[model samples]
Target chain A: MLERALNGGKLYWTWIGFLLAVFGVGFLFYLQQWNVGLGITGMSRDVSWGFYISQFTFLVGIAASGVMVVLPFYLHDYKAFGRITILGEFLAIPAVIMCVTFIVVDLGQPYRAMNVIFHPSPSSILFYDTIVLNGYLLLNLLVGWTCLHAEKKSIAPPKWVKPFIILSIIWAPSIHTVTAFIYAGIPGKHFWLTAVMAARFLASAFASGPALLLILALIVRKFSKFDPGSEAIQTLGKIVTYCMILNVFLLGLELFTAFYSGIPGHMHAWEYLYAGIDGKGVLVPLMWLSAILAAVSISMLVFPQVRKNETLLAIACVCVFFSLWIDKGFGLVVGGFVPNSFEQVTEYWPTLAEFSIAMGVWALGFLILTVLYKVAVSIKEESGGEAIH
Target chain B: MKIERREFLKLAGLSAIFGLGGTAIAASVQQTPSYIPDPKELTGKRWALVINMDKFKTDADVKRVIEVCHTKHNVPNIPNPKQEVKWIFTEMMENVFPEQQDKYLTEHYKHMPFLTLCNHCANPPCVRVCPTQATFKRKSDGIVMMDMHRCIGCRFCMAGCPYGARSLNWIDPRPYLDPKKINPEFPTRMKGVVEKCTLCYELIAVGKIPACAEASNGAIVFGDLEDPKSEVRKVLAETYTIRRKPELGTRPSVYYVIGGMKDAGKGA
Candidate 1:
């Protein structure tokens, strides 16, 4: 099946080459970061975490969203998702890989990363996060590979694979939850201190993850023989609509708590992100763009006529993906650090080196994703278009 | 030398097991001796500091305290405020105690500089959040200590701290140090490690106080919080003192004595 990926047309090879080139350039920047230290990035003593960690946070949500498809298909016995469940799992593999890579790149001492394992502190949420993330990655690879292999053989998946599938389903949510706990349980970071953080993370993840899966499903439909079923795509759009609404509602709740309570500590972070504190508003415009996109996406997605229209659905998915990308990937992490512990504002903007390194990690993820999806789609195509499942 | 394949395999497996077991036994037997406290070493149940702001009347007074501690600790003198590293520094009173400030507050209090450093909290969030116990609170005395050698430099401790106390060496700090002024006794830090004031634990081990306290004339008091007779306890009791973000429940060991004028005339 992997050999099918190796035997792609000119366009497929060109795409692979492009991703490799981007990855190679990013790796060069990463090597420089290793030598010069984290100071090469725009992070300061005040805003310690920047683009890399934020990307890690957002990608974890994407990885966890695999469970959205897995649960409905396996537990509820929804036959519509039967063709797309493997796509969800394959997406997870690369998202988790990117999450782990972002973490490694964000570390000041990448060489000492093993210290997290050698001297594990159970009290640390990060320790649990590391365990759950790696565990989720392994689970996805095992389940996705085994199931795809069974499909290739035109047989029911082994009895042994059932328990592993169920475990993977349960393990998926834990990864994003632990990632949220990384910020939520911190002592003085008021923005992340809210109880709704994990919920907000899950909501945005469910919305953005399926939105991406929908876009990919459409691309697969256009490029290959596999359709992923019109019913499955429509159902995914519905899922995205409901989750995006919930995500926006949760943000509204946070805003209410911050403003209504009139606590300076509670309000300051939101003010810094949305309105700016003392005229330092680097994130203000980006946050508003995220808000407007979310509004537009939700409005378009809620209408059944628009969702049924393939072209509108694709546009909505793109809007949801980038909107959440800006919100969770950019605003959330940076917002928590601004008006830094001293009640003094210190804005952060990633340097070109940080952006290049980050772009490299994303390209590496997409490259892996391309290879995995190629194999999965080829197997589906070989089995005479969805009959094997 | 002429053993069969199966026999050779059995011998190799047995030797590997014995080799591992022997190494384990040797390691257990060669364990490092337990630390012995020197007779002259300063011992405390819980170490604490009291910064008497009234005594810090002049700018030079605060500067000297920061200089002495940073010089002793090999803290970098990076020109960029964002990347700068320091063991101790000063902040305006309003910024130091934002919750306590109001428009009508006296100009004397508003403009005053309060010395700041690691609180070495009783409930250190940095220690709790550290994936590796690279930063930990010492059991002998409640001083938060950082093991630079063990830190993976994840910077979780920086986010965990509410005081903005910790700093990561963003670049190799060696270039920032003045070779002529470098203290040969103190180890210089490498890039990609988080460091902060350890309350001069090295000095304390040899029966001396923290560098900041030693240089502050009478403004900074260092002593055991558990000792009722200690200078820190006396100052804290006689004056109205506050810790940074006390509501967060970290129980910071460093206290600021606000509005106390008993030693206001003192100069470094």
Candidate 2:
């Protein structure tokens, strides 16, 4: 039975080919990072965290958004979401995996990521985020797999899995909030120095992350046999639209407070992002592109017709995902570094070497997702083997 | 062939139903800690600092404190910008804030160095927020300090500091120090760790004044804030002093008396 389940789907050698190419490129970049240290990456004294960390920061939100969907389905017995629950769990696994990899790459000492466990700092939020992120990953993985094992045998998932789901349900936002606390707890980086920053972060995660997932749903619908309840997809899209609007509102509030009050410390980031300080002209087109994409995506999502149309929906989803990714990845990270305490506009762009290494980390994440998804899909397909090719 | 995704509907429903209850549990535990080892010893002293910015008259004086502090500590100065480290470095606010550079201060007193370092806030946020126990506030005193080897170079502390006081060494900081210019009094910092002024910990640990205090030749006052008879306490009592951004409510331990007009004007 297990062999029949596993052997149903084609091995997808094309995917394997793509994965290897990404991995090879990534490997070459990783070598550069290993030999030279972070110098090969664009980081400096004032803006310490750059490409690696920005990706980490953005992905943590994406990882946490898995729960935004998870909470509704498993814990509440939302029958509509039964088909999509595996995607959430598995997507979470990759998001969390990516999140972890980003931190490792960003660290001046990748090996020392473990010292958080060995030499624990109970006071630090990063310590707690580390703990919760790992625990959350294990919980989702264990719960998801336990169910998968039952699915494989055509049996009911054991009652023991309930506790893991419940723990994970509560644990998801904790991971994101702790991630936010890593920034919000700081007293003086004006842009980051807000109690609401965490709230804003989660809000953006809910909006942008779900948009990414819904977009993924459309892709799967196109390339795969998974229908994954369009009603559920539309419902999640509505949630993303609602959250995205709120996120934009909060961003407006942030800008008003900084610029209207005329606090240079607070306004410095705004200028760096929108206006381009010291004529760096660096974040100029990127920030505008992000804003326009965000607006169009939100608009597309607002209308039922556009949301239902797969091609259009995919376009909207891609735009929103890229928009938020650029905002978080480039805007926020580099923005914080600007008007650095020294008041110099130190610009950072990821070199080909850095970008390639980043691609490697991302490829590694995708590889894990691919394997996990393959196992999950095969088992699910066996339960209803008549539909898929 | 199928790209089957296990749709996470049930989990999504679960979180929405009880997300707040989870948040409430989190809310109860969310009271974060601060690095300021504020000894609750109910002392006659709430710790404070009194800086005579005027006493920083010459570049040599500013250089003296940095030199002594760097030497006393093993602060390496690697030449690359990534690794460049400093236990004490001069920051021209004009240099640091050139765009906001005003004519009032620049026109009046062209080259007055604020000689800034870690304000060591009574609310030292850096100590509590460092994940690997790398940065901490000394129990005996409120001076926030760092342990370099333990630092993972996460730089979260740098992000959290309200004062913009913390710095990260982006490269090998040890190679850049001018050997002859290297001050033998204090230690230097390494790359990757966040570091700032320790208020001359070893100096104060011994029966001596801080390097900055010594350089000022009685211009800058240093003594136990706890001691009623201490000179710092006396200065605190006598003068109407100011701190760098009291609005942030960081409760900076470093106090300042603005001899120059540019002093209080830097309200940011």
Candidate 3:
């Protein structure tokens, strides 16, 4: 079955072909970034972090998506995720790869990324983050591959595997939470300074990330016989609902504190991000659109009729993921920069070179995800494992 | 039920050991700490600013400070204001009397320009939030200084600061200093890092006055708060003065003695 799938043109090459073309185009873009440096991106000194950091931020959520399945399978012993759990773990591999890529490209000296290690400063949250993110990546690859290999041989996983899965379950939240600490730990940027910022980051990540997986699960079901089933998608859907609710609620708390305080230093960030401050603002339209879409998607999740429908669920998932991506990734970072210490606004636009490098990194992730899913689907089909439904 | 007391004790000890062993393998997880400025630095002469808004008036005064410092420090350019990275910027705000802020400032009068720069606070948020210790406070004199090479251009310090004193080099700004001229006193920064006033650290080190003080006609005073006889202490003692954002508790060292703003009273 594995040999047949690998040889079958209709089975997988189409995806491989399409992904390659996109990846090729994105690679060309990255070349321009390599030649010119970050100056090519739409970023300015005022908005030092632009799209690349946003991509890094958004992809961390996607990488953390593996936890949504891991937690249920290990914690609750929900075998429903067994058939598709590998997909989540494999998705994380490329996503983590992309997260690292984005960070490297975003740095002033991409070569010095190793300096983050050679000169480790525990006081720097970024220093600790490098350890957690890479460690989580290795853990996922080992556990997911080891389990899948055992399944191919028709044997139970090693006893050691149990502890690893249990650990990864807790480790998943740690990834997003540490990513949150990256923002929350900043002292004066009032928008990011909130204590709930980490909770909010996880809440939103779990919501949007699982929502994306549900969409992927549905697309797989439609295009291939490897459909994981309605039961799994719906279970994931419920996770999205609970998370999106908490996520949106946290955003509300932020706004409440921002306006209520009346501190210019605090209120100004909100104004610059959503409303434009002192006549210079960039994120207004993108932020507003994301907010509206997120609200609509939340309402759709709440209504059972809409949530249960596969088509509506997929649409809602994609919308919610994009909405949260813009909010968490682009807006959160850029918002921190505006109405700078002097009450002056500076403009930062990502140059084409910057945008291209970002695109290339994401393409690399998609390419890896496509190949991993194909292998998982082939194994599941051959083994006749219980359908996820 | 009373079969073995020794066995019971052994069982208890074994459970405790296993519990500790199990938890040891678990990942060490710690939530990020809440940001509270250390008072240890502030406790000993937490130097602060008190601004006198009355003295600064006229373009000449502003120019005098700019030039005196510009010549002294080789502060590169005067031609293009956009290319200029200011050590100090002057501005004026109408006095908000009955409200005393430890770091607050009155506006720069055409007759009086309120100078603004790094406040060198006891609780420097910029220092605490810097991911890299590129920006730090001096141990001996309590001045905040920046190292350009180490700056990753993350700009978190710029965002963390309440005062808009930090500036980013949006472009390669060095050529404005006249391609031929170079000053070793203040190293020009590469693009993408932040730069700010160092309170003329080199000047103070060399026993020279801060540029702003040298430029002014006795308008600016520089001295040690630790020494009551220092010129600054005498001025701070004789005149009622104000500090910006007294409520935030930054403990700024710059003092202001705005004439009528004493009715404005940051003096207390």
- Give the top-scoring candidate (TM-score): 1
DockQ of each: 0.75, 0.33, 0.15
- For model 2, the stretches where C-alpha displacement exceeds 4 angstroms are A1-11, A31-35, A260-264, A342-344, A385-389, B1-49, B78-83, B93-106, B109-111, B177-191, B238-240, B260-268
- Lowest lDDT block of 10, candidate 1 chain B: B20-29
Which run of 10 residues does model 3 chain A get worst, by summed lDDT? A1-10
Error of 1 at B263 (Å): 9.4
TM-score of 2: 0.83
Q: Quick one: best DockQ, which candidate?
A: 1
Each prediction's RMSD over C-alphas, in Å, is 4.8, 12.3, 12.0
Worst 10 residues of 2 chain B by lDDT: B1-10
Worst 10 residues of 1 chain A by lDDT: A380-389
User: What is the lDDT of every predicted structure here?
Assistant: 0.91, 0.72, 0.71
Q: Sort by lDDT, best first: what order?
A: 1, 2, 3
Clashing residue pair totals per candidate (backbone < 3 A) = 0, 64, 52
Chain A only TM-scores, each candidate in turn = 0.99, 0.93, 0.94
* Ranking of candidates on DockQ, top first: 1, 2, 3
